[model samples]
Target: MSASTPGHDDPVRPLPGWFDDAKLGVMITWGLYSVPAWAPLDDRLVRLLAEHGEGADRDRSYHAEADADGFDPIVTTSYSEWYQNSVSVPGSPTWHHHRETYGDRTYADFRDDFAAAVEQWSPEPWAQLCAAAGARYVVPLAKHHDGFLMWPSHTPNPHRPDWALERDVLGEFRDAAEARGMRFGIYYSGGIDWTFANLPILRADDVARAVPDSPEYAGYADAHWRELIERYRPAVLWNDIGYPSAAEPEKLFAHYREAVPDGVVNERFYAGTPDFLTPEYATRATSGGSKWETVRGVGLSFGYNRQEDASWTTSGPDLVELLMDVVSKGGNLLLGIGPDATGRISPEQDAALRELGAWLAVNGDAVYGSRSWRVAEDRTAEGLRVRYTERDGDLYATFLDRPSAGVSAPPRLAGAAHAECVWLGGDGTVGTVTGLAGLPVPPVRPGVPEPTVLRISPAPDPR
Candidate 1:
């Protein structure tokens, strides 16, 4: 990882080496919004934005109070974590559900329920699950857009007194993750805080304006951020939406780096420098050459959506392929898990994660500490998709689909001397590599098909 170019005032910061090697990470988005754990279960946010064009219509105002009909985007938003803002939109699905389920109760009214649920929660299972899934790091949300803090913060919210939890959930999670030899990070919603601005974002344009720019809010956010750094010393300082315009993010970045030299900052800081870029639900080909991460939930929403079942969530095999695709393009995958109010991971999500873990336990060498190869992708004669990755001077070819016996070698491997060929998940080498013209493929398994990895030693230089 190279150092980023310095801006006019912001200093240059190099990305931490461990980040690139840490191919997979888990992000936990559990907060007050989990109490309801409800969303419309509509199309993913990326698709909605593409179809609706960011909901920006100059002719009409889409504010909920002005015209509920114009705010179709918010009504169908899939992010359950935006409950506070969503419930504020009149006639929106969330608004209707809130009225019908818990009449006249404000979003903050669920505090007691959340606290009760937190009492039953334990960080042990979460950390163990992440470790089993071959995750190299864990990032838990400390504060979200709802302005509820998961930790007992020293800087209390002025508008919502006693809004933070007495228990240090973030610290507990960090300790559990680190105990398993995984790095712990924190995610903070620095841009929009409902307690500070109290604005319901109905359109894409509303997002920018929703950020609280008041000096008081800036000082409050800065204080909380500094506290988080000084206490936890997170490996990654991830921010979402944007930072306050009134705050000096450069100073914050300097403070964080000085406190933890190897810590990295994400690109969401609207004002300061970033150690890496974070692309939500984006493909490696689409994400640029810089150190970036692809973030998305097991289901549609980062906050648990009760309506989402196995059909709506990504399958285990698909998750493995997604990680391979992202890693092949020099990117990391920060998969998200949204637990319910009781901190219980849904069965559907848990199964998928375990399946992914099972696969990683067998073929992790193809992923962890691997870099992009000469060609990111190729197709074999059997029409099977193949992704390439390189580590320790060896080339890895991952077949997305099961390949038939005696599959033909890809054109890229032609003329390359294969010192050894080992089929991951199988006993050592698959017979002997007779020639470069053809290579043997592993037998197809009975149940769910998984990506097969073939590691070729002494890879031919692509230069």
Candidate 2:
């Protein structure tokens, strides 16, 4: 297989076909900082406090207090900022702080606390919900940049003795997904671990220094990655930022493939490009020279942000429409959830997932195990637009958006001969979709908004 070069202009290539089947997935985020019982999604209290005390000479006293308490003042100060910014701490920054301060705490201190939290983290309902909604696979954050192993690691960070999370969070998620018969994937951060390396920048210091390729850092990353691939053998490896140079991720990708031959690696490894192009927080106008998956947070934030306003949540119709639009053009959707300080996903997030799952359950036949039919038509031409995807003997002519006016049910296939249309909402009938416009228009509802889908017969051939 020929891979892309640094500055080459090439058409988007299909990632392994596995991605096509992985239309919808979930990204889970949890770590030590979540134990703080604070919401950082929308709050900036800690940041405000930090700024208030920014130039104060009290920095000296703060350091003394941190040393006496075995807490890293830099971390605490940064944590404050995280809370203020979004009520959530950034992964690398928070993890580095935790390791510096409490790396000496025994598993006896937080092991059960963390494990119990994960053991009770029943994503089965979530998975079942997603599958019911239309997701073929589920991806969990095996480990973020915090360097706190969700699985046990033999390679210990000498600097942060007690920081390794002994419990296997990924294993639990894997079992949960398999039990539900959903495919499992793992998200790994490629770089940025202050516990094992020096990042004066995150510590609020200016040091233009290169990260030393010391044995300690190498031993930690290599051993931990080996443990992840060897133990879980994840189907997909979802990664975070910090790649190409700092971590020499291409080397890691080579190692990953050698360890897990059939495993899939994302663009975060080589550079900003992934095995599939993952558009974060937004949809892409075109596939980025590869199969694509859009990973968007439910709200403005990805992690547990106690400060997030529930009113800012995403709606089921909008999300469903987004999925349809992407899948219609051949793409996948990766949704995210931030586990709270106690390792619990917020109720609001759960509701949003459930809503999506409900929508999927009703109209899943059109989504799961399907291929994009390359019909070129404008979605905005009318309220309801025609897009076809085929699976088995059925062709799905999905409505790009909602219906409007008296457009009756779903629009007909553009050039297909003699087919019946059935509304996915439990009604099976060929309703009135006659229009020269080649789309349907439904009567608008007063307040309730949802994207309606109709399955059309006489499936189109890929050729």
Candidate 3:
């Protein structure tokens, strides 16, 4: 209830306990962009930024032709959700693809197709999938950068009349998620709306420069946020890009808190404080000792990309490892999934989510409601990666690789001579620290590469 400053050191409001305990969330990015669902299978945005600094500009010479090797981070962006902006850039693959496929068709033309596709979408399947994927929460995009609204809203887009959908997608999703005992959240692109300010956004600097500074846009975004909160009452308000300079996020946050007392806001609001920090495709060492969430797509693109296949995505084992790493470091993983315009999740993506859920079904004790241990990370004698987490007075040591015979226990666990060990999801028989040198290797499930979890009880005191 205290009014705190907007910075890492000070949060506007404390994060609810459910957020940290949730550990895993599924973010859905679907909109008009999914109608085309096309993006060059180039490197991910993070790799592109790392290869050519974020400030780097696109080559002008390649603006007239499609060069397979042409370099333009923004133009060739892997995020299909940025389709409108990418198609606006001349000569880029996305631009050329747009011209060739839908010649002379404006980006807004996809709205009709998107609407037709939505008629077939049922939020029930999505809710079921998230629940099956071991997601404690689900956040679906209400309004993406394309300025197209996914749900019917009372507050309409002034520039594009009736741009919103007729179906209450957000409300339907919220009801479905809540019915399944999962929290529901909303993602809104508050920074740049193509309808408000049509900037190609060809360069990194253009991202910020393109934010509509007009009072009209400020009021419009603010109204939309309020409407979403009033209608859906999401548990998480996940804003993307950045907020408008003209809007007062503090007032919005206050209103949101009043509406959803346990709700949390992401850091992208730009103006006011956030309940948690969001890092896209990156993770912080300690997250500055504040709660954080790592967001990344099942593949390179957050929006469905026709070009991406199984090879482009992280494997099931890798996904489990990523989750272990984040949770062990006191962070949550907000894994993203982009369904096509027809509301169909890709087979590869579906399989990966199921696989992750399968792993969680067995070893969830190490993840759910767990906190980072005193030693968050370490290496075993065999050089295999080990991550530690604590919950309910028990320590969990997750090994990235299957431990073999003679593989010594991690240094932290080596001293616990009286500790009792149990292989999670295995038989009820308990193992003890025989000599404080090595841990007994549990039988591995054939063909499954998921990380192994070991629960250890602390030594009893000599009373």
TM-score of each: 0.90, 0.71, 0.91
Candidate 1 structure quality by residue, lDDT tens digits, 201-306? 7665466567787999999989989999999999999887777867799899899989999998987775677877765655545323568777778877788999
Clashes of 2: 26
Residue 154 local lDDT, model 2? 69
Candidate 3 residues 326-358, lDDT tens each? Answer: 898888999899999989999999888888888
Better of 1 and 3 by TM-score: 3
Q: How far is candidate 3 from the true structure (C-alpha RMSD, Å)?
A: 5.6
In model 1, which residue pairs have backbone atoms overlapping below 3 Å? none
lDDT per residue for candidate 2 within 57-102, as digits (tens), equals 1211221123333443333432221322122234544444445555
Q: Let me know the TM-score candidate 1 reaches against the reference structure.
A: 0.90
Instruction: Specify the highest-TM-score model's number.
Output: 3
Whose lDDT is higher: candidate 2's or candidate 3's? 3
Error of 3 at 139 (Å): 0.5
